[model samples]
Target chain A: MKLHNPITLLLSLTALLLSQQSIAAPVEYIFINLWDEYVQQTPLPDPHPDIERRFLHPDINIDKPSVDQFTALFPVYDGLKIDTHNQLAIRYGVRQTPYRLVVEGKKVITREALIKAPLAAHADQPAQDQTLQTLSGHPFDPTRPGAGFRVLFFSDSLCPFQHIPNCERRIAQNNHLSANIDYPVITVIKPFYVDHTQVSAYQQRFNVNHEIVFDSHNQLFRRFEVTDLPYWVVQNRQGKVIYRANQVPPLPL
Target chain B: METIMKTNLKTFLTGIVLLALSATASAKPYPPLQARTLADQPISSSGKITYLKFWATWCAYCVEEMPLLQQAFENSQESYQVIAVNVGFNQTVKGVKTYLNRYGYRFPTVFDASGSITRQYRVTGTPQHILLDASGKEIYRSALLTDELRQHLATLTGDKL
Candidate 1:
């Protein structure tokens, strides 16, 4: 057989590099159990039996891959069984499950965005600016440029049930972040026919270390389209919305 | 004198019947709650006003509301009973014990590991206060620590707080 030419060798090397790049792209399935009912109803549906049979079978002699690699190999349609009692979910700031996250490298692609458009279509957009007044009557603007990140926490003070626990968790998480990390958290009390007294009561109820503002005019709520109590929006230093969810985001450690 | 005795006897029987009827009307039976405490002692609600507080160690609001529950427990020693039911849905017995120990909370706590009792009571979150009257009928249920709850608890326990 004739020896391969230099051009042929270069072409083959380029093809091999391209294949490696494709394989190296991080595409992982992040399965999280958001509700107790889901865990009670296990074993969850095995959506990718072929993948499970090929990679997870006991007969396979392949070295057990790292958690990231194992998740990467998981089919997009499949769900993993996770213990609701586990602390790992809590550490990730996951309060409930059916919480699916499609992560490529360090970026998180929310299920809503993934369903609406392509993953690349979800881009960091500028957070809308709105006038806000603190409980002490100080003017606050969240969209103002700052050095570090700002967290806009929207909660209803008079909400007796869900928002209470959620706000308490947010306070604890914010305190932790404040002590360990450098970030400003602004808690906006969304107006729900609540007066200053109720707002004050809520403020005193939780050990809130951040500034508490009252959006009595529903400025931020309308601007952000927040229809739920105990919602959160995180903005980067450039005043761009980085993360928006009902649950408080884990400190970017 | 004979007529007077008859009248008194009639009054006494009427009072007895009324008392029995009142007791029957007020005391609706609650779902049987039988569970083991962290100390491995069985705790159950009896024919007294019961304050069933469903809580978990991981819940921040639950931890905050514990002191209030403890106060109510201390005050309501004679007139009623306070049982802190640990809704251990996503918690371990060991964790609950550690939390109770760490907080030095002495409120009688029972572990509902399977959440059956929680489901029966329709408890969705921690620090849920369900006040059952002396007849076992639920009188008050709230997840908030308010003046109304304090007053209701006070009336139930007959403690002037």
Candidate 2:
């Protein structure tokens, strides 16, 4: 069978793996990670209502700016010393991911990482779908089903990795701890791609008595701002936000 | 004479104990499900020894292990029957059949769509191996199958794995 561009898929999975391994520094278009897939949950119709514009007038693509030319992108740093997208590119040394220069009437404000293509602007107020049910699939209002220590699982019981004994043998080998007390596990599921049935079988068999919620339409994916499997957000039941675990070393038990 | 009878009875009980221990030393063989032929139907064998390997097209590790399994099958086809069970979650029947063809796999295959069988066997993952004797009794079940297992099969089939 003809395999679709193997290089691209490798690059993508590699990018995801790298993002999880690196330290917490704002990556340029770092959506290659787990929640990156969840970001896709938003259809063409529903976008992020919150006008969290990372850049202004990101449409104007200057010819691949030279390293020094990138200096013009981010004219400001730290305290907003007239942020320029050019200088920001130079600081970050970005030649691959398309970045934009944010300027306000010649006075540069800040350089922000630009999207590859124009993002569909839905920067409105956060209007969560009132249709979300609880983990039990019942109408969950007043009490936040999401307002607690969330445990994100990335298991397809169908996958042989399930037998890797992560749950069974509990190997003390190299572990990838997705959640921490500092960052509770805000569990997410893989999208319904080719192996969705695997996930369905897994959920039906594995989640014997555990609580779970599905992003069937990827709606919840947009809200919590997730895009990957096994990705989690650790928060408190008190509605206090904790550190979101991008990826951490697994705890050896 | 009464004392003599009691001593005789104790000796008989001791002999029975030794026999039971010897039987416990060896685990009995089991009979498992048969594999389907290239035509997608169950293929049976008389006094048959079967190795049912569960695998998928997407798994990298599973793919890596295939050539070794193929080698093992080639090593012993006459004495034992090797059945490859395709545990696929996605893809058309054509896609699966095409893959098997490309692999040049000659062993009979069985397709499980809903993965109900995978669940029934408590199989968490692959490459899983389930061995059966002639009567379809399950003998050995393991997730990490190795050459040692092949050697074990050789003993059951009275051939080399």
Tens digits of per-residue lDDT, candidate 2, A1-253, equal 8576989889989998887655332322211111112233211212234322242111111122221222343332111122233344334333322333333333444444434332221211233454644345655322353534444443223222333334322111102233223433322343332134444454554433343444444455455544222333444465443533334324321
lDDT by candidate, in order shown: 0.60, 0.45
Taken in order, the candidates have interface RMSDs of 16.1, 20.0
Off by over 4 Å in 1: A1-253, B1-28
Question: Which CAPRI category fits model 2?
Answer: incorrect
Q: In model 1, how large is the Cα lDDT of residue B117?
A: 79
Task: Give me the runs in candidate 2 sitting further than 4 Å from their true place.
Answer: A1-253, B1-38, B45-47, B157-161
Model 1, A37-89: lDDT tens per residue?
21132233343432221111110011222223334544432333333333333
- Chain A TM-score of candidate 1 vs. true chain A: 0.44
Question: What TM-score does structure 1 among the candidates reach?
Answer: 0.42
Best by TM-score: 1
The recovered share of true contacts, given per candidate in order, is 0.02, 0.06
